[model samples]
Target: MAALSAAEQTVDTEHFSESMHSLSSDAEAFPADSAEQHDFVVDFIEKEVGSDLKSLKNVSNLLKKLTDENNVLEEQVLTVSSSVPPKVSAALSAAEEARCSLEELLKKERLISNMLHQHLQGAQPWMDNLGQILNQVDHIERHMEYLRCLQHIEELSAAVQQCLMTSSVWEAIRAVDSMAALDTGLSQSACSHLQDFLRETLHFWHKIIKDRLTIDFEKVLTQLHWPIISPPTQSLTPTASSPEISSQLELLVTQLLALQTSDDLLSQKDLASGKGGPSAQTVSLATPTSLAPPLCLPIQIMLLPLSKRFRYHFFGNRQTNTPNKPEWYLTQALMWMGNSTTFMEEKIQPILDRAGADISARVELCRGLLSLVQEKVASDASRLLYDDALFSHLVEEVLQFEKELRSNHSYPAALPGLLHLLLEDAVLQKWLTVERKMAVEKMDAMLSAEGAWSSQYKDISDMDELKAPDCAETFMTLLQVITERYRALPCPSAQLKFLGLQRELVDDFRIRLTQVMKEESRCPLGARYCAILNAVNYISTILSDWGDNVFFLQLQQAAVSLGDDVVLRDLGVLELGRLASLEGSLFEGLLALLDRLKGDMLGRLLEWTMREVIEKARPYGQDRWLSLPSQHDLSTMTLSSSACPMMLCVRDRLLHLHQSLSLSLFQLAWQGLADRLNKFLYQDVRRENPQKHCLCFYDLSPTSLNV
Candidate 1:
């Protein structure tokens, strides 16, 4: 048994050695490149030997253990070998397939993108070409339409020219020498055709030019430069065909001149006459004998030779050649001269002559002449009847006429007429009041020069420099004149003594007050003016009455009228001062007035007056003289200066008023103070001084509170 066991072991050992040798040979042939390969070999050997050595208790147990271990080893080896090779092969194939699919998709996307790009590129040119083609077609169609319209217009113009040139039409037009005497139906037809032709021509031209081409034909006609004809020589050869037309034109001119002089001829009457004098029975018609012969007489008179031989032959004898002789030649010459002179005299000289008759009439005439002059000036006409020299002459003539009217005392009854004339003339109306005043002043001067009344010129000139006088003297003079005229007339007029007395009283009061204001220097000029105004205001209060006292009422009304000048002057000063600082003198005058107004209704009135000033006055600019200086620029010297001290005094006064008065009064006082402060602050800031530093320091200190 031991030998058999030995023999089995030996056989196993030998078998193991042979297997190991084969494996070793295979390993050598392959040349194992890793430690894993060496580890696998060692592990196989330990598994085969370890199981056999650990199981000595039963041979069957050993065998069973060994067999189970061998089976597990065999299965692990098979599983590793088979599963690894397939998995590796499958993985490699999958990776390659995925890469190829991805590449194919990328190529397809690229192709699609390229196709879209090419498509857009191809469409762009087609859209541009289509747009260009449409534009060309539209332009061509528009031009074609314009050309067609132009063709129609040319045809219409030609037709119109043909109609105008017709022989029958020319004869018919010539037969009626005057435009008014032409057949109504024929004229209407002609006018209609002409208008239609013009319309068509204008439309065609507009279409051709592709713009507006319409012109004002009437304006063009008025501006036409007609050629002047020279005198024809007796030896000149006449064209046979032109004679009839020339004769017809000459006849037409003769008739037109005659018709122009006939003012009574209406359109219907002229049209019905048909070139012959109106029927003998017509009520409105002038007698054929009464109407002057046609202008052909003048043409004939012009044709006569001026030689002494011809004159002698035409006059026949010495008795007929006398200056006053009534020979046919003399009569014709006189008639021609008279006609020419009449036309000129009526058109120009009479206008001025009529104007010179009275002040009002002269004013009206001057206005009309001015209007005519303006029209000519605006038109820029080549020939003006009234040149600068002529206009100056006319003005001098007007002045002379005014002088005459003043000497004659014609203005009282002519005021309304003068006003009407002035209103009608644009040039004269611009300074109507000034012109009227000048005229009145000139009259007054004349009266003074003539020594017709007391010399008020000195008083007037003195007052003119100081202020506008209340015009009370003039009003009074007018009232006195009217009352005297009314009283001196008759028994019925004697009752107007009451009216005269009242007028005299009112006038005396106004004149005396005005003189007092002018002559007296006791009070401020403003106070004196205010006093005059107060008197006028009192008169106005009486005048506004609608009650019965004819003469008394008029006297009061005159006083009221005198006040207008004062009010206007005051308002003007107020307006001017609103935009600037009030003059020191003016302010002093106002302060004087204010002092007088204390504790009275005048004080209350002042509140309203100042309110009006504040509301109506524009806010002054920052550059105004009253503006204050900035803190940085202010100096101690400035603070202690005369102007600053005055301002501070005024500010203190206003502060007192603000505290003592009602809210409204307080606000007004504060507003005045604020305006003053602002002026000082802003304006003083711009001035430079070394003392400014000290003043600034003083301002910063608590002691500045008192300042």
Candidate 2:
């Protein structure tokens, strides 16, 4: 609007200039032309001035209208311009605030982005750990499905207990079967607690069922008057209650057989699949003999009367309960077994046969009775071991009982009899210790006896036999008895243990001989010394012979089973490896003893013969012996009959040794004496120069010196 107003003003100014220029042109044209020009100009002005005046009037009106309009437009422009600054300032301030707010928002967005980045970095490991945990969970979920049966386990447990308590045999068995199946299935669970809970529940059920069966079976057995003490006669007949008792016994046996079969089948399945879990492994570890068989409980129940009787007669303070006669109780136990086992085999075995239970009632009966007997014997032996006589009787009776069980009754080897208890490592160790101690005591007593070292060569009935002193012969006999008693032991460890004990005894004997040798008077050629030498030789010969015995040889190759290395080492088996022959220990000890004897005999011979003989022979050596004696003179002039004191001493010593020692030992002693005497005569009796020596030079020939 302002530019339009300015354009209108410029057009009006241009028109006014054009009009003034026209008037000036007209004036110039009319210049200086007197009256005519003035007249012409006045005419022209009158005509044009009239039209211009009218036109100028119209223009003045138009200019006035334009001036008014321009004034109104300028006022309106001033009003708008005046208000626009404050409004623009308000707008600019508002824009500035919006910009600041945008900057703050950007800063906050950047900060949040950085925090998020840091969080992501820290959470990387967490994510990885979560992934691993999820994988483990997945794996557990795969195996945990097997334990799903646990939800009903408490219910099954209650059901089994209820059935057992109510004497619902079939229902109880079925419930037990369900629990067993659950146990077998859940054994593969990865949860240890679940497996433990399931197994505990299953085992409790088994125990409950077993107890119920035992109670019912005992009732049946009592009703039948089972395990009758006396022998059954050929004309014996059944009683009115026999059919009911037999039927009840059959049902009890059937239930037991079913449970046993379940255990067996579970074991076989685990083995067949080659998969063992805690339950399967536990079941597999149980053996019929190690633990009681299914029939063992009833068998024990049947033997209750017999056991009571035996305990009454033997275990109490009765006359028959004497410790001196363990065989009394042992015989009674055997008789009970003989009486009961036949009846069981004839009557109870048919029940098993009818039930298809593959177990021997006879064997189980004997095992039960023998178990009672073993328990009694072990109890008695524990106290009796402190008494030598009682202990010996106990051991003897136990052996006799074992022999009867194996030989007379044809006892099953699978079932451990009295010997197993007797041959336990601890028990066997006690027995070995007792034997060793007793042997040592006996050996000491015999060695200290008045005539213990006297040579029994002449006293023996057989002249051709080699003879030793009483102690040596007795020791050999004791050793033979010990060997015979333990030689038939089935356990290699027991056999090796006994063999090791024997070896220790041999070494101990050697030590005793050494002590005796040291205690004896310095008389190497005396009767006692000769007897010792003969004893050493005799024991050595016996040990050497026994070392090669088949029993010992087999023991050497036998591996030490259930034997303690420390105990075995104490027994001298450690010097030999586990499988090495233990006979070497005995042989080594005897050889050492023999060497000591030889050296002692030689040293004593030299000591005694050279004690005063050298000084006495000084006079003899001064005598001349330029001429040698004849052969007949030499033959008659044996040292035994020689009158020279040196010859007399040698003759007396050698004669004594010959009379006392066995022939072989005498030869050994003689050879040692000959060598020693030869050295002595050459070195001590004779002068350094042969020409200076005289008296017995020719008399010192081997034949003249021989006894």
Candidate 3:
């Protein structure tokens, strides 16, 4: 890259050449094609040097004034030195030294003055004078350069004729271009003659060279033994694998690319031909475009016959009938050519051992050629491989080739262009589309089979057997496969597609699980409660184990609303001072159902024990009422809760019941049941301990107070 920058710097330095002679010496140099560039250069030159005459006049006048002052000082110093006193010999010595110094200064000033005067009076006017004899020399030089350029152009014409006569089309191209670059200052008659010569000579060269190149190309086709296919050739690959195809393509690319480089060098040069020749005061110069590019016309014509075969071999069939670009062949040819040239250099460069012609320029030029074709190949290759299979095969082949290239430690300049053509984002995205569809289908197949949803539940009723879903492992495998596909593609939108697919899968699974939960809720209460708790616990456990994976985080979030798990998880007999903590009446209903179903025998036994306790309370309650401290106490004792003593048996039976049923609902039911027991026991406490001054817990009816 640094070397390329240096080459650019060198080109720019030589472009605005120091002199017309230097410009002519570098005969390849030509002005830019823009007409404005020529005028810009001329204007820049006029601005740089148009004041030379005026500057010379001012310098001459300043020098003359300094000379006159020096002469006057010399005369005054000499007079003072000659009249020096004999008694002060030191003063006389000083005066004589000063005079000699002043005299030396005058001589130097006079020499400078004379030189400037000569430049102004002699050189400047002489250069401008029409009457001067030097004008004849100027005219002679103009006529001589005109004759020289004419001779050079004529020699070029003859060279073209000679090359075509011998069927050397490459040499004909060089000669024709040599004729075109002749920018000799032209009078009307000379220009007319030059134009006529070009019109005739170039046309003849074009006709013969095209024919010659075409013949050469036909031989190339025969040498390769390629199939002669019709227009819009079949898609095939074996022909492109041939090593000889690249070698033959290189031969054609090298000749044309060299010509293109020569034209480019010519175009950047602002000045042309000799400045030693007379100025173009009367004659107008020819436009630089007269010799401009598309300089490889012969080469392009040769490629036309070979293109059908090349397209079939390297590019395959064109799908559309729309005509391919004429220049598109140039890019295809350049790629194969660049690789071939680089390969040849590797083999040949090591063999030379500093013995012969340097291949450095050839190598650099080939490297430069790759950049010119990069954009075209990148665009064309992307369009060619839109099919998933086609794109996949091409990418695999390119990657394998790239791997081999690296293993050999060979870096070809054209490899970047080739690789760029294969690694297109559109191609990657196409693969991602295929991968996503396949992944989703595989996932669907795993779960869409007979009783597929049931299989995922896998003995969830048995806690130890409740492992991850059967499809979980297979789903992960598919996920990984799709993830790798996404990694290979490495696109923003592709990554989004991957994430979205996983999200949908997770969501669908969660929705199915939620549906199962709702369905299970319809079972007998005990069974339904156990089913929901076990299934949700198993799911939570499995999901939690896979919890670190982001996909499972979505599942966990879905499981949040799965149960009253949050309400049931921490409630115990110790914490059940109230039933308000439960989400709704479901807790109360569940407790009653459980007692009816599982605790019925225990309830009947407690009822039998309470009947015996209620029989013992018959008369003790009536005697305790007469022993009351006052009538008010007796009035309060009108009601008796003699059955409250049996509450001890209730507490004991409740303890036994509590031990057997410790669920959230059992604890909740106990809260209301305990309060009712307290209300019955309250009347007994007031009647038995009258000094306690407490009222009866119940407001008994008169008939009901008989106990």
Q: Which candidate number would show the highest lDDT if scored against the true structure?
A: 2
**Tens-digit lDDT track for model 1 on 259-312?**
232212333333454533432222112212222222221122222222233345
How far residue 434's Cα lies from its native spot in candidate 2, in Å, is 4.3
lDDT score, candidate 3: 0.46
Measured on C-alpha atoms, candidate 2 has an lDDT of 0.69
lDDT of 2 by residue, 630-662 (tens): 445665644322228766666777787666667
* Estimated TM-score for each candidate: 0.23, 0.56, 0.30
lDDT for model 1, on a 0 to 1 scale?
A: 0.38
Worst 10 residues of 2 by lDDT: 279-288
- As a whole number from 0 to 100, the lDDT of residue 438 in candidate 1 is 42
Off by over 4 Å in 1: 1-120, 165-513, 516-707
| Model 3 stretches with alpha carbons more than 4 Å out | 1-158, 166-170, 176-211, 220-442, 451-470, 484-707
Between the candidate structures 2 and 3, which one is better when assessed by TM-score? 2
> Candidate 3 — worst ten consecutive residues by lDDT sum?
279-288
Q: In angstroms, give how far residue 313 of model 3 lies from its true place.
A: 11
Off by over 4 Å in 2: 1-225, 231-301, 308-327, 345-356, 377-396, 419-437, 455-457, 461-464, 480-508, 553-587, 606-656, 676-707
Each model's lDDT: 0.38, 0.69, 0.46
Ranking by TM-score: 2, 3, 1
Candidate 3 lDDT score at position 578:
32
Give lDDT: candidate 2, residue 587.
52
